[model samples]
Target chain A: MIRRPGDAQFTAFVQDAWRPLYRSAYLLLGEHGAAEDLAQAALTKTYAAWGRVREPDAAYGYARTVLLNEARSLFRRTSWRRELPSDDLPEQTHEPDPSDRPAVLDALRLLPPRQRAVIVLRFYEDLDVERTADTLGCSPGTVKSQTSAALSKLRRLLGDAVLPEGALHD
Target chain B: MTERLSALLHDEALDVPVPAAPAEAIIAGGRRTRVRRRLGAGAVSAAAAAAVAAVCLMPSDGSGLRLAPDPAAASPLDPAGWAVSAGSTLYLGNGATAQLPDKVKSIYYTSAGTVVRTGTVAYTDAPDSAYALVGDDGRVHSLGLALGDRAPSTDPRLPYLAYAQRRGNTGHDAWDVVLRDVRSGDVAVSVPVDGSFTWGGWNAPPVALDGDHVYVGLDDATLDVDWRTGAVSTASHLPAARFPESTSGRVALENRSGQPVRVAEVSTGASVAELSPGGGPGEGPAAVSISPDGRFALLVPWRTCDDDNACVYDQPASEVLQLDGGRSATVDLGDQVGWTPDGRLIRVTGQGVDLCSPVTAVCDPTGIRLGEGPVKVGGNSYES
Candidate 1:
């Protein structure tokens, strides 16, 4: 294949953005194969829009936004296999261990796609309400409501161990 | 609480083995996109560049239209013969499918042909969107236009595609609502709308195209823009509406309280018909789509998923409301996106296409397989 002038720089960007993008995709989509596909699709799209990306340093942010958008689209597709939420919540009467990965991931899979995205963006990505809303293409009020709803649901499911009292106050 | 949740999330994300970055594949995809963009470098490319430049150098006089040949008279096909795009293929009413150069994001019907928006993926909001006009003969003509986030609006009776483009920075109160003739690939009209408009969730102002008028959604009010003469006025009839969905000269209005209470005439604030009030709190029905003649409205009731299991059923008992007599029929709206010009409800799914009637609430299966993937009907809001 013939190489373009910006191929090397874009290759470097893909290498740098791959891991974080994959992790974020994994958090949004609980499956490994789907997460890998989402991350790669996002990076490929970022490359397509590379000409518009004025600042090279901002490439990662652009890729992240693209990944979130792709995740949103995937959630909307009817063909996508949705993880059905069970009526039962795992009993958690004690302070939950932070390293308890299954409980958190399962709880996440239980939340609606939007609420899950809000949790991932707010807690994992550490984005504020406004930035999260901007990235998710929603209103701040929507972000806040979804965040509150998600936290309340998570608290009920995981109990005070993982999300303690006054957690919803945040 | 934030810290604990954050820690738990980090712990969950940690140790997930990431595969090697496919840099070569990504670069190759990007290269293919660039080449596809330059498909017709002579006329179409020049026209696209001119349109971009005209937008960049928006005239202060509110007259940015670059003159081109008069568009051919609109000759829309039978409303029964509609088209839909699944993946990269466009399934026409005649049972012939045309493969698009890229993944079809959304399709819009014009008298000229089915206007197709193709992108890297089927996401309506994806970047680097390219527009093409697909004829009945299955010939594809690239419009060479890449409208970033602005949704394209079209009236089946008209040959132009309209959208609102904000001028300058966020603080700027000025916007140029452009109408591009799909046939000639020229800016037929561009008028400036001055206001500190807030376009709620949309990257740019949302617009709805009627015969000669374009209703532009702004923060405080909807502007009635006469594209032919560049006359701008407030469509007080619509009030402060966003995502103004319209066809057959009627605009569907959503209640500020989140319910769709009525459908109104665009010209006059006259009530076309009063929509049935949705269910009680949290169960309100959403006005999803309107029939082409504005005589029928599709209302899908909101379903509450279990808080613990967040599982939403695939299909809901959607209803089609006759605006004339208040008669309603139950139909599945999960896959129904738009209406045929003759007023039949168009439902597209991975299985096939189904055309339903609003009056009888009965769907006639087309048995036309769209193959596999997401399907976007031509008259949907994503393509307007």
Candidate 2:
């Protein structure tokens, strides 16, 4: 059973969750600085609502929900412009060869925000269907359907050379 | 099968050096929230403060708001560090050394757009209006609340810095481009293009301005304009057989013949060199992007799979092509790699499906993956 989060509890919550939250924002926004702003905005909103939240254990989930929602909302309000200037490439001492990565990213960007969110939470976070559905505010069946559709599109855009062994089986 | 795909994607993660200010940023952001609340309370009357507080405290209906953990109580913005997550959240240092502006009014989409800022540094003031520039044909367009009476154009690229003006209408489809002060919205210069550029349409051209030259990349070719003199010149004529799509700073050209072809930068009809694609064009050009330094080109080759019409059931195979001066390398990304803006690291989507099971065959119907890194599946070297 989760208790109501008090001011002290809320402070502790922010301290523990800030790093992961920040990372999530960066992954979604793709810009370090912008990601920081988005994360902060989400955090501020969470702080304001701490008193009303029912399940304190679910606070992280609630905050994550807020962050994802904020990201999607920002995307919607901004009209989904795909191009952005690169301030600096993520610093890599050793440059790996570029393969199908660019194409994959491009295809991912083409997806609608909901579908994209589902994909990110499912794969990157490695969440199961139930958790993914819960996070996305959709049914597990919808998650299954979305995963199917997204993968099918990726396979079609990329070719067999990129496919892993037994990728198209079943 | 899922394991293999996971391994491949795991290999593609770019080992980015963590920024030095993650802890500081979290702490600082937390402190700022507290200070802002106090200041907000003091700045407004009791009634106003209560109203603002009520609005902030209201339970989110979960319509537009997604929930996440709070950071204010837990961490202060640490200097010398930054943090990124798969969930699209990022944290930066909040130390005095951190150079984040006091108030960031707006962020432009690309290098072409300008992020407008307002208010005095170190002191809160009224909200500042920011504008983003979009260019089409040969004229520039401004978007945001600041442009009172002016309309936006269809051009994809806008100058980083520009002046705007409203001139006499050229025709039903024609309009004049005027230079205006960004701060005051007063026109300082004006230029006219041949056609009327409409908004909310597909196949729009991307425009970029460098010094006096305005570069436009259209569906067919790239155009250059002397904004000062109102002269337009064709820099490169794209082959009609190839349909070009421009986004961000990169352009994608697909050949209808299905034969692998390369598009190289040409000067005055002279061929400079062909951009390499790791190996020979295997399945034609799937997608192409030029690096910011103009030294490298990134290519994703087209692939064929069993679930052609269906969604991705298992790991989709795609080839990543790296093109540098004379050498080309192909890195097998058992999956797709998303490119960052600078074109250095490719963000790989980690989600995979178990193709052996009919139930989980197509794991990602949304066709979206979240992760960032560089190409690592096949042995290929990237020039830093």
Candidate 3:
């Protein structure tokens, strides 16, 4: 486990976590420019309030919380739309697996802010309900309900698509 | 199918790109913020120092630096030789892009008959269009169109406006909104609504038109209509007991019942999960506006200090509440009301006219003026 991060410690911490943090922001924001901006903003805010943080090991979690809040704030400040290229690209050029369905992301984008956050933390981050609730600053019951509601909506929107067998358990 | 969907979501999640230069950008932003804070501190210190010097330099006879008072600083209400409204008068500048001056207020043609302005400008941009009302002079104007293209047709009533028409004869003809070329009498674009299935009654006029969408207020339903396709979607709706007053897709609805108003996005229809301004009942919502970009929702809450009700009618204390996603901030406008075209600053009226730039929530009483009529501070007066 990492020790508590001070101002000096933050520089190293940021350097280490920057990549994954950026990836998480990109997924939440959809636009590369905004994702970059959001990630940097979260990190900067974390640095500014570092002295107030009680636990050094929890800095990463605190930064993630800031990122989530910022992502939600950005969504509110603008009508965010992910630019989906309409052209059919060759399989080799596609970043994700060619067989991966894009409709799921589309449906996910349609969900409201809170539900979207819950899903991102629960599924993508592989966090348990209590942990997800802790990160979101909400009760575990709220997290459970939001996750259930979001999954139900996703199911309705995606129709025949279902979660992979071990995906939820993870 | 659920498994497939989850897999796809996971794949997309993994493919999201990381930003390359985050630290540099944050550092730059921090530098700028630090500079601004220092500048503000300097200004405050300078003012304090000046006040002390004034006291120290005063002669026993009481005459100190009494040369001719600078005329520029004497009259606080003097106009700064610039147009003083919430929006800008020019298109290329940093403020709200100016709308064409000669055109009528807020009249427009779409699938839903002619849309008229209610005289309020929203703070956020609509998801689809730039909605405005035709002015009282009966001239039709749009925000981004060139003056030559905006000339009203000879028919007057049936101006050659641009609109999106419905294809074939779908029973959902009600959803067919269009953008008309008022001068040429030609249909510019016809958008087809593919799968939208719900329709809320019209509450207000369509305010702005973007390339494919028309921003309209259907009775209590605030929505965006695809001008090319007749796709209809709800953006926000009016709270109960609140009838809409002047509106740009963002509206000012009055809660006559003195109850706190709650609005929700139509997609989550009739669910508490989607409701906003979830305050206790009885706290009425004052006139409110949304930014043109649909990013921020501004709520003005009014406090009537008198039981006569007449006192509360015109001089209620007004507070502006800006809601951005889960975060919210309260801005004190004193008297200013309307927002600029870009939604960056609000035009406020009070002791002297001023602009409250929301990015900072600071009021600059530099170059603003109050016009005639019951001067609504944040309301839009551009529409006919």
Report the C-alpha lDDT of model 3 over A1-170, residue by residue, as the tens digit.
Answer: 32334444666778766777887766554446546656776776566556655786887888877676555333322112111112222334434442454466666666654566677776776667866654543445556656766676665454433653332322
Off by over 4 Å in 2: A1-170, B1-173, B176-190, B196-212, B217-222, B239-260, B269-282, B303-324, B332-343, B350-384
Q: Specify the poorest-scoring 10-residue window by lDDT in model 1 chain A.
A: A77-86
Candidate 1 error regions (>4 Å):
A1-170, B1-77, B122-125, B167-171, B201-203, B281-284, B303-316, B332-337
TM-score of each: 0.57, 0.31, 0.36
The alpha-carbon lDDT assigned to residue B114 of candidate 1 equals 80
TM-scores for chain A over all candidates: 0.71, 0.54, 0.53
| CAPRI level of candidate 2 | incorrect
Worst 10 residues of 1 chain B by lDDT: B44-53
Which structure is stronger by lDDT: 1 or 3? 1
TM-score computed on alpha carbons, candidate 2: 0.31
Candidate 3, residues B1-57: lDDT per residue as tens digits?
A: 234544566777666555454455454444443353334211100000000000011
Model 1's CAPRI class is incorrect
User: Predicted candidate 1: what Cα RMSD to the true structure?
Assistant: 19.5
Top-scoring candidate (lDDT)? 1
- Native A-B contacts reproduced, model 2: 0.04
- Give lDDT tens digits, candidate 2, residues B19-127: 4334344444445544533442111001100000000111212232211222011122111121111221111111111111223222222323222322222111123
State candidate 3's TM-score: 0.36
